[model samples]
Target: MVLSAVLLFGASSVTSLNGVFAQDSVDEISESVGDTVDNAASDISDAVTDEESESTTQEHGEMVHDDEGRLPGNIKIEREPTYKVGDDVQINATHMPGMEGAEGTVIAAFDTTAYEISYTPTDDSEPIENHRWIVQEEIAEAADQEDADAPFEVGDEVTVEAYHMPGMEGATATIDAVNETTVYLVDYIDTESGEEVINHKWVTEDELATLDGAEETAPATSESTTESSEDESESEESSSDEESGSESDSTPEENSDEESSEESTPEESSSQDSSSEETE
Candidate 1:
């Protein structure tokens, strides 16, 4: 009986040992599998993060036109009391965003009065329906100065060169008007919050500089240069129109040659026509 008891106890101990070893092996495999899953998840997360970063970078990289086609900087509008067309001057009006102290090399200086105008935003969900700025009737080339944002009516597309709202900068905006009264850098207080908005706005020609350059008088030579440029532009336009007419009419010499050849070779024309039909 004692021997029988010893045998029973030994068998039970063996079974307990086998159970512990099987459980340990299963635990080890589960731990390794968990580690692998974690590593895979981390790699996927990192890849997603990298892709998002690259996409954001590319979106901000390519900005060509400024909010107003002017170069980057805060530009001030300067008014010359005696301004006119083809005047050389710098803008000193604190009307340009980021250009209060910055200098503007005149792209075109005018003497007539300037006015700030408005336009409806083209971008979806943009807040500015009619943004106000400057237009001078003297400088505006459009047919009407009072029509708000002439380009809006005329369908001239324009990209944004300035920003009135965050993310509005670098976003392509449409041109609404080409000509108007004086433009201004405006400081409008939001009725709800009283925040300052610095929109580099456009005004009339009179709103700009007459003699905005370094306050020094230009020599009479400048007048001659301006006149010459105007003449050249007129000449260019005329030349362009002539070229278009010539192209539309066929080269005059080529047409004459064609007529002469047609008279000489009516048989050849018929033969060629027959050949084309055969090929078809």
Candidate 2:
């Protein structure tokens, strides 16, 4: 009886130890799974925050030309503009890539409301902040809204119809500031790409300067000189041809007179010979 009791106690102790180890393993596995889930959730939250932050960062496309025509006719120049239409000026501002140091031709100028805005893109991508120079006419009013001519104040939310950059149109934007200065539409060559950018919008007077010694100015002057030289060359050629024609036409008459004089000399010589023979 004693032996059997001892054997039973040993078997019971082993089973208890096995149960404790199994419970510990289960607890450790549960803790590892919890940690993994927490980490995954944190990573997802961080990614979302990062995406939202990136959306608001100011980024633009290389080309943003839609809504780039003239401003409204009602918008007049409030003061004399520093640069006039058809003036070639150097760009001092870099509103887009490759704008600074580029040569621009002024196409239009008008004094109207300009705005700095922050907006979410229409495609629901990242938001853009502090975008410059979206004009008053570029904002699309809500259908029910009144007061079309009123300028927007800071913190006012409006929909942008201007495609100042890609995904900018139809975006809801908050006005950050307003300016009542003359804005110019211009054509410029991309110094980097050498491509022509036409009817670029909203460059303020402060952003332009006289194009003294700019890269394009030198080439234009050289071309003008080449044209002038060509004209002079053509004129000289024409004058020389006229002079040659006159000399040739006069040469024929002189030759005919010389031939007549030679024939008369021969006749005089024959008469002298006949007189000499009669004398002999």
Model 1, C-alpha of 121: deviation from truth (Å): 15
Q: What are the root-mean-square deviations of the candidates from the true structure over C-alphas?
A: 27.6, 9.9
Model 2: per-residue lDDT, tens digit, 173-207? 99988886788888888777677878887788888
Candidate 2, residue 227: lDDT: 100
Each prediction's whole-model lDDT (CA): 0.48, 0.80
Model 1 gets an lDDT of 0.48
TM-score of predicted model 1?
0.29
Assess the local accuracy of residue 261 in candidate 2 as a C-alpha lDDT between 0 and 100: 91
Superposition error at 157 for model 1 (Å): 7.5
lDDT by residue (tens digit), candidate 1, 94-172: 4333333333323333232332333333454434434434333212243344652333433443444344333444344
- The number of the candidate with the highest lDDT is 2
Those runs of model 1 whose alpha carbons end farther than 4 Å from true positions after fitting are 62-280
